[model samples]
Target: MTRLMDQEQENLWDSVQILSQINAEKAKAVFKVTIEKSLQQLGITVPVFSTIRLSVPSTDRLSQLRQIEKKMREAYAHQEKEKAYEYLVDYIERLSQMTEDDPLVVRKKLLASLLNERYKRKPKWSAKRYRLSASLSPLLSKQVAAAYYTTSEVAKKLGLSDQTIRRMCEKGKFPGAYKTDGGHWRIPRKIFITTPEQDERAEEALQQIDIKNQKAGYVDEFDL
Candidate 1:
């Protein structure tokens, strides 16, 4: 399997280079064959190919196609083979509609939205509120006003690691995290617990600080 993967990578790399040099029809042929061979090498069946209708030959179009390829590589790089293979097929089909005028920015947003839809566990209203606020500012009518923080922030407050927080999200234990446009996870503040132990700890710390300050007559310097 390792050897097959190596060969597939080589083929894909060679095909990418060749795609830039060849005519559109030839490039398409090479790409299709490479995809097919790669799928076969992995003991997977290739789905029906989607034909890209290129209206123009330009660097911008080439770049979009390449971006699609990059997305495919990134998606499959660490995923289960069966799932990765399936996603790649869908990605290639989407790539076929490349036009020089089609905005890469919009394309990327569309791709992210699609990918998120595919893997999303469920709608998280609280996470949605934070994300919508950050992106749209004024807030969409659909957004609920819920306090959201990142996993890191939540982890710090809860005395947990970001990984543990993420596991909570996956398990539907955490209320929900909104993945920001920039891909940062946002946790709803409403879901956070300020336990009695936390309050006790905070109070203890304040008491210690107060005691130290009193000996030095630093009462004016302290707020608590």
Candidate 2:
């Protein structure tokens, strides 16, 4: 509320503040009656007032409520100032409309009319950030696999560095592991092996060939 030169104007500002401060529905109704009498005396229209309750729990909620209240107060003050601006514009428009000669005045009034246009609502960080933190915490700190090995454990078992294992999984070289809420990684036991079987098979094949050649071929000339 602001100081006014006239006692009637002071009463009107007081009525507005008083009406908005009433928390209970019944009290607000009585305040509105008082405001009506003030309005009749001042010959001015009163703005509608809405009460908002903070429902969240905890100390954080207290800070959030205070911040919201501060912003709401500023918004109300802005609205009141805008009303004064609109009154001046209305006065000018009335004068311009009487003359019906100034196109620039008409354009200015049209632009001024849009000054109090609806503000776009912004997303609240309290709920959004809290939910997002919950959602992502599971992803980052989960445990998932047969060996109860985290992805890091699987990497260590495979003789690959942790960074290399991550790169391999990202490149689709190895299957992904599951993650649990407790931040453990579990890899499928099938992907890990004792050694490459192909090398063992090649060694057996070479021994078989050497035995066959020794049996079929004649002895060396020196041995004969």
Q: How well does candidate 2 match the true structure in TM-score terms?
A: 0.20
Clash totals in order: 3, 11
Over the stretch 1-224, how does candidate 2's per-residue lDDT look in tens digits? 12221343333233323223322332233223332322222222221111111111223432342233334334434676455444434433432332223646554543443342222243444322222224565654342222334566645343336765555445544333443445433444433322123223323433433464477553231121
TM-score of each: 0.29, 0.20
- Each candidate: what lDDT? 0.47, 0.35
lDDT of 1 by residue, 1-224 (tens): 44444455564444444343533444444444444334332323222222222333355655555554455554455565566656555554555454333545434544554455346576544444445534564555235334566677655554346886676667555435557767666655433223333334433443444475677655344333
Off by over 4 Å in 2: 1-145, 181-185, 195-224
Q: Where is model 1 more than 4 Å wrong at Cα?
A: 1-4, 7-11, 38-47, 50-90, 99-224
How many angstroms is residue 133 displaced in model 1 relative to the true structure, after the best TM-score fit? Answer: 68
